[model samples]
Target: MEGTAKSLIEQTSESILNYIITNNLTTGDKLPNEYKLAEEVNVGRSTLREAVRALVSRNILEVRQGSGTYVSENTGIVDDPLGFSFVKDTLKLTEDLFEIRYLLEPRVAALAATNATDEQIEELDKIRLEIEERIGAFSDEHIEKDIEFHKLVSEMSGNVAMSNLVSIINQSISRYYDYYTSNRIKDETIVSHREIMDAIKSRDPILAEDVMRIHIVTNRRSLSQNKKNNLKKE
Candidate 1:
């Protein structure tokens, strides 16, 4: 009897998750009332409540005082599922991240060149212009814009799976950027970004891929050198 009850709870939880996914519910989307949800999932109120409690514990759901439960804004991969935080070698982790970016982003840029809509291409151009205008301002906003530009390119690739993977990698890179202390924005980087935008505008997949590769590789080298210098000073 206990095993059967547990199974029902698990199934109820899964059904709720599926309902959210099927309905295209995003972060902050309100869920149906408990009674309605229980009815829809063909589960008892107790079972449905237990399932929702579990999801809330997992950071997948949140219950507001009077507003009811809602999906979490950062639902997927809430914790370090792989124990990346336990890894002592920060340098290697950073390197691995860049290596992953090197493998994925050039291909993403190529696809974006071929598949991106006119509006998306125009958006990319706008981001590039923003970076150019902020080159000497020494504001971190440009760095953020750079990150957004890459993410936008990934989305423009029209591959949802690839875009999700790039977002994960880009998040890791952004975390690293918080620790990397550099105020100087290179002229080469600005020029390279412009070239990449031009290639995408021309719908030249090959050129776009090549330019992206050079851009990522250049940044990777800079980070590696910075790591080495920091280690020497320490």
Candidate 2:
């Protein structure tokens, strides 16, 4: 009987997850109330509560007393699923991250060129202006804007899976920028972004992909050189 109960709870939990996906519910989106969900899933209130509890423990849901159940704001690989915390070789990790970016982002930029709305392109231009205006100001806001620019491009790709993957990578790369590449935003970085913007503006997929590759490759080389220089100094 205990085993059967456990199985039911597990199945109910999975059903809830599927429901969220099917409804296109994103982080902070509220789930149907317990009563509604229980009715929809044909589960007892107790079983539904148990399933919700399991999801909460997994960082997939949150329940507020006065409010109701919500999808967790930080869903999907909540924290450092790669065990980067235990990594002793930061340079190697940075290299690995760059390798992944090299593999993913150029294609993303190509897709963005093909799919980005005019409004999205205009937003990118605004972000680019903000970045250029903040250059040499040593503002954290500039770093955030830079990250936002990349995020917008990923979203413009019109591929949810690619957008999500890029978001995950962007989180890790944000840390890298904060720690290792802070203050490394040069005029060339701004220029490269402008080139990418122009390519996308012209709706040239090949040019967008090429410039994006160059942009990432240039930064990777700069970061690599910075790491080597720091090692020499130490």
What residue pairs clash in candidate 1, if any at all? none
Model 1 spans with C-alpha error above 4 angstroms = 1-9, 22-29, 44-50, 53-65, 71-83, 130-136, 177-180, 184-189
What lDDT score goes with residue 2 in model 2? 63
In model 1, the worst 10-residue window by lDDT is 176-185
Off by over 4 Å in 2: 1-9, 21-28, 42-47, 56-59, 62-65, 72-77, 81-83, 133-137, 176-184
TM-score of each: 0.79, 0.79
41-86, model 1: which lDDT tens digit per residue?
8888988999999788777899998889999876854555445677
Measured over all alpha carbons after superposition, the RMSD of each candidate to the real structure, in angstroms, is: 3.7, 3.6
